[model samples]
Target: MDLSCFKAYDLRGRVPDQLNPVLAEKIGRAYVEITGAKKVIVGYDIRLSSPDIAEALSSGLMAAGADVFDIGLCGTEQVYFATSHYKMDGGIMVTASHNPKDHNGMKMVGPESRPISSDNGLNEIRDRVLEPFGDAPQQGRYEPLEVMSAYVDHLLGYIDAGSLSPLTIVCNAGNGGAGLVIDELEQHLPFEFVKVHHQPDGHFPNGVPNPILPENRAATADAVIAEGAAMGIAWDGDYDRCFFFDENGRFIEGYYIVGLLADQFLRKTGGGKVIHDPRLTWNTMDLVKAAGGEAIESKTGHAFIKQRMRDEDAVYGGEMSAHHYFRDFAYCDSGMIPWLLVAERLCQSGQTLSSLIDARIEAYPASGEINRTIDDPPKVIAAIEAKYSVGAKSVSHVDGVSIEFDDWRFNLRMSNTEPVVRLNVESRADIPLMEEKTEELLAEMQRLNEER
Candidate 1:
């Protein structure tokens, strides 16, 4: 087994070279051993190699004396739903999730759809896979189940069907697993869906399913304007993260969406705790506080966020990367629920998406996360800290280095999954100052790179 395939949160690597059937089988056996799970659920995405990997994983699980339920052709979140909904012991979703075409991986969860990160049980499974183990004396059973209708029902439970307006929504699935769920949910709703790249194409003819990149965003934005739709939504490859665009076809930043969703959740629950990542803070803090809720900051990453939400008894949690977690939804992030809640907000408020977010965006102009590749990430980070920490209002290292001043602030952190440093800058309703400070930080990073 190639150890590099195991990541901080999940398993992801190039096909055959790093991840394949044999290693997947080993992972399956190791997971059963570590969790001591008697029953497990397995699922796959639209990737070309997903079915084979899922089959291998199921075989290994069955060989380990664990009953396996195969839920075919589903998104990552669907596995989460099935694991918790069916009261299964554990689950795994075969997906690369917004990675390039030639890559594949797995997202694992324990009972109740709780995450299995490196800190909890991922590293143990990784180590066990490297050792030798024989099959059990007797094999377990395998069963097939259909979860689409039930999954759609669970999704619709988040919002009232009668309250939704008859608005046209542009849905760009990016040829991933999201189209199937969207189509299923459309039958139960009153809204008109203008589908784009709706088919599940493993080859990704349109492009990779990641809408966070500017190159992949144009199709969704263009479709929204051309269709004269109320709003546009796009999802990643496995559809665990969803992005939104306004009626004017402008791509709304996920930072403001976090605030918006936090506010909505607070309103629904009256008063509760909301968890947010440390990258961008002011907007979420302001919104949560104003809504009579407590705001908690956790380190970035899904594992950390979910754990913090559980610990704090938070009603909702959100990351600037468009991952939203809910207490009602097993404390797991859902790509499907955020848009539905947003749609409900629009319908009940009788306001366009732009109008709803305009004030928040204006009040806190931000530079959506900028990434830079440097030879020495630590040195550059240290340099940034040393330079900016003098006479600063405060400095914190919860996830990375975040420095604050009176009106402007920025957070610089190394990427957990990629080899780049992410920088995010924001100011109090000052776009010019945000741009200037962003450029200044970039120049400093460049200088440090040159010195290296």
Candidate 2:
């Protein structure tokens, strides 16, 4: 059996060939056997193959003597919510989350909604799938769980609705499951929503809902401008990550959003730790300190940020890739909570989104994440580091090689899944200097790659 669908963080691959009902059922049984989970929460996205695959997974779980609590047609966070909120033993979300339409996958979490990735039980579950399975002494039952009301209530608890005044907001779901959630939250808020691509369609009429791609951002930006709204928001297929657009119909880099969210969340917490990814730092660090909060950097990725949050008991955590995690929400990332907080901030501050973000951009000019394909990433990185670290104030490798000078700093790291090396450079209130260093770094990297 082809188990190539199994990945380092989660499972994702072409459907039917690498993943299907047969493999899903085996994976489900293996999950139960490995975890000894008695009660499990199951949810799926709006993909065409999701329901059938979820059904088969549940059958195998029941066969292994684990009762299933099915939360149908929801985002990945809903599974995390139901599992931890209701005290389920574990949860599984059948979603390919912004992958190509023809692909499918699953993300699993153990007790307390802690991720079950390759470092823990995911690999064991994959290995167990190939072994034989026997029926349990007693079969387990299945029940459809209603979680939207409780989940939505939890989301609302994160912000001060009393402070929120009337404003026009644009939300583009890109024909993904985010629309279902927006519709549910709409009745309780004062904002007038300008819905674009609002319907939940497996066909993805507007294409896959990945807003990080430049091409996918136009719908939300155009809608915000066309409706004359305060701001715009977009989400990926499972609605676990959300991107932002300012009132002027300009896409805001996720790096800036991280700083904004950290400041906002710190105000509510009165002073707490904020975990952030290491790829970009100066802006977030400045804002976090001014807000009377400590900013801690963690290795990029959901699992690493979440584990660090749990360890530090941080109030909030954010990544430049649009993933935001909340301490109140089982240390799990949410697409809904971040936007709600931003909306509240707008109402209280009474300033346009651009004004709020522009000041930060001026204070800290940044080269948003840039990727380059390198023949030998390690060799090129080493050469760059030897040449660049001579007069640098400090150099560290939390996730990648980050070198800091008095006026500027840059990080160069290789992608875990691809042959591309990612770079991010920033300066203290000097856009021209930031741009110059960015160009110089790229040129040096290209020359080094040629040598390699």
Scored by CA lDDT, what does every candidate get?
Answer: 0.93, 0.94
Q: Mind giving the per-residue lDDT tens digits that candidate 1 earns over 242-351?
A: 99999999999999999999998888899999999989999999999999999998999999999999899999999999999999888999999999999999998999
Model 1 residue 437 distance off true place after TM-score fit, in angstroms: 1.2
Candidate 2: what lDDT? 0.94
In the range 159-243, model 2's lDDT, one tens digit per residue, is 8989999999999888889999899999999999999999989888889889989999988998898999999999999999999
**Predictions: Cα RMSD each:** 1.2, 0.8
| Candidate 1 to truth, TM | 0.98
Candidate 1 residues lying further than 4 Å off, grouped into runs, are: none
Name the 10 consecutive residues with the lowest summed lDDT in model 1: 156-165
Candidate 2 C-alpha error for residue 379, in Å: 1.1
